[model samples]
Target chain A: MRVQAAIEVAAPPETIWELVSDPARYLHFMSGITRWEIAGEHARGLGARYRTLMRVGSAEIGGLVEIVECDAPRDLAWTSISGIDQRGRWRLREIGPGHLGERTRVELRLQYGVAGAGILGWIAEQVAAPAVRKNLRRSLQELRRQVEHEQARAAAATRRAAARN
Target chain B: MQAQTARASSGDGHAADGDPFARDFDEHEAGERPPAQPRRGPLERLVDAAATVIRGRVPAADLDERDPDFIRESLPAQWLLASLWFRGEVRGLGHVPEHGPVLLVGNHSGGNMTPDTLVFTLAFSTYFGVERRFYQLAHNLVLSWPGLGFLRKYGIVAASPDNAERALSSGAAVLVYPGGDHEVHRPSWERNRVSFDGRRGFVRLALEHDVPIVPVVAIGGQETALFLSRGEGLARRLMLDRLLRVKVLPISIAAPWGLNVGDGLGHIPLPAKITIEVLPAIHLREQFGAQPDVDEVYAHVTATMQETLDALAAERRLPIVG
Candidate 1:
């Protein structure tokens, strides 16, 4: 099954990517994520691998995943190296202009299924879709909130610095 | 290992009390057992032959029979049952070693259906992908049951020390329930207890193999049915211990067959929410002396498991609703 959740953030794509690309920040924003740890040497870039787990229903489901596509400030995609077969992508686009001057549209897309699971697999996918989709949607909301909050803090800090100068 | 396997094969399932797998290990280990049974009638002889034939049908513990592909395919079905019906929640899986031969000792419950086994197997397989070699020791009768051969593909072998040694030697995590049939068929009132029935063979197995022991405690399986009694007296009177090596003829009030006897055919387990906690691994030599006393280790293991089971029991606001 495929699930996607999107949100508009006040910061630029670069700002959002900074949080999404880093494995360390997943627990801070990703809902239902129980674990996300670097499995190999590389921490970032296309070849980096991470051991990931999300609590859905009765199991902490996920496995080693490698970053397949890591385009800075725009897109990052990962595919499973083991465990449940899954492909995940983070898509970011710079929206023309909002009240906040510049905004980024961030979408988290995930497709997961057991390869030869047949009819029950189909049913399980459908039953689990809502929960997985909710987690993604909440994760994006949390990401947007964090990014926008940080931007507001920086702007305030800049205003105070200018006044002091 | 070969000698142990040979001795293990001598008795399919005829151990005395406190012996897991009903094997003759206790007789060999301690040299004390119940006296030999008297001469048998024609009916008793026939029953013994039938049981022998059934026991002969048990497949040899070939670790190669574990089919990773088959296990992967069947996981969805197990997931559905565990998620929707049992509402299984497994915690502390990280306590199991990342990769190695570890002994997972769990408390058995839910009688023949064994919902805990179903839930834990799914959790473990999903937690550590299907490629990892993992085996679970089951009662001889379960393996001998007709139409249940598919279980072997899931890496289930007959409960025997030699089989466990093979799985561990191959560096696969082996799961064993020291309680076996005795505790699994206990009365429901004692559901919250962790009763291994004074079995310490698991500790010896771990010490001999030099593997870490991880205690897996689970609750709510007993609520799956209204277990009335283990029927030890009845089984003894019927000579089932001699003929089939079955120590208990459990009686319970279960669905599809009220006042169910034997539970031989199994029954539909109630939708009881199962919660399993995997305790941190215990390195026997590290925790105890280099040459640990088997009795002391057994006591410590059972006590730790009992404490965990108590905590799990305390968390339940209701029985099956948990």
Candidate 2:
């Protein structure tokens, strides 16, 4: 099953990138993910792994997933190494200046397939599709909220500094 | 830290010159006619989202749902008794997972007034905090008692596959006594023994849910009373198993009620200095093969618990002392 969601954040691409680039911050934005922790010593960049557990209906599906692709301020993708078979990607695009100025468009895509269960796997995928889509949309919404909130705080701080000087 | 200091200063209409951002923020704040509402950070937002998800996913009828206020209110009394009266000492709590579903299998002791259950429950809830989901499976009759709303509030649920499944599905740490009434009512002479009465349901529950099994071995509960026998024959002849789902009609000697039979009405529990030790989690797929045999898993769990119980028993210098 494949699920995709996107949200436009009123913040600079660099501002948004600061959050999405850090694998540890995924827990702050990811929805339906019960557990997301760095698997080993490597914290960032390609080949970094995370021990992830996703809520699928009544049960939790867990796996060790590694970063397969990573491009700062642009794209990040990961594929499962063990347990459940799955892949996900995050794409960030600078959508130019908007009403709020310096806008960034963030998109998330997830594709997953259950292995070896045959008919049961297909049924689970079908059942899980809606939840996966909901999670994707919620995740993007959360990402946008965090990026915009940070931008507001930074802007306010900058204003205060100018006034004091 | 910088932001926090800046915010604190700005609230007082003063900005520290050390931070350039603090100066401009103060002017922006002063220029605004209306006070700005405090903005919740990403961490706070994430916590709210998680709480919402848990509330929505966990069923209203879920037996494992905990009332934080009630648990908090009862903690003082329970803790005092556990520490002062029983001298209850719990070890190996680190073996339990900080999060995620887990099955805690332990031997039931002290018949109807199982102090082991109380001590462990109090300790577990206190350590994990009341917000974390936890459930203790008990016989249906226990839940049938009137005016015991406190039990249900504390996440005591009727022992059944559905209840267990619901609790696990909701990602609760479920504590199950596979031995049930039979093990709890065992003769006083078998105090040091680890007995689950050959029940293997707990093994299947862990495998089916793919949760780690945490073994909790407790001693000294049997010393709470002088148990004569499990009264299995009496229970069988009376068809108590079929009617009440009670497998034992225990005979025990206790104050107020000497030669207490059935212990259905409850008895005052002797402060036997209960000691509970939790062992490392046993992952079924890792320990046993993927397609693990039920008997082998059962034996492994029971044997491990027995070994730990024997060790704890050996450490005791005298009855009700340690």
Which candidate wins on DockQ?
1
lDDT of 1 at A124: 91
Query: What DockQ, on C-alphas, does every prediction get?
Result: 0.83, 0.01
- The Cα error of candidate 2 at residue B118, in Å, is 0.9
- Which sections of candidate 2 miss by over 4 Å? A1-165, B1-61
lDDT of each: 0.86, 0.73
lDDT of 1: 0.86
Model 1 lDDT per residue over A60-82, tens place? 88989999999999999999999
lDDT of candidate 2 over A130-162, digit per residue (tens): 877998899888988888888899899999999
The list of candidate 1 runs beyond 4 A from truth reads: B1-10, B13-32, B37-44
At residue B198, give the lDDT of candidate 1: 75
TM-score of chain B of 2: 0.80
- For model 2, state the Cα shift of residue B262 in Å: 0.8
Enumerate residue pairs that collide in model 1. B15-B22
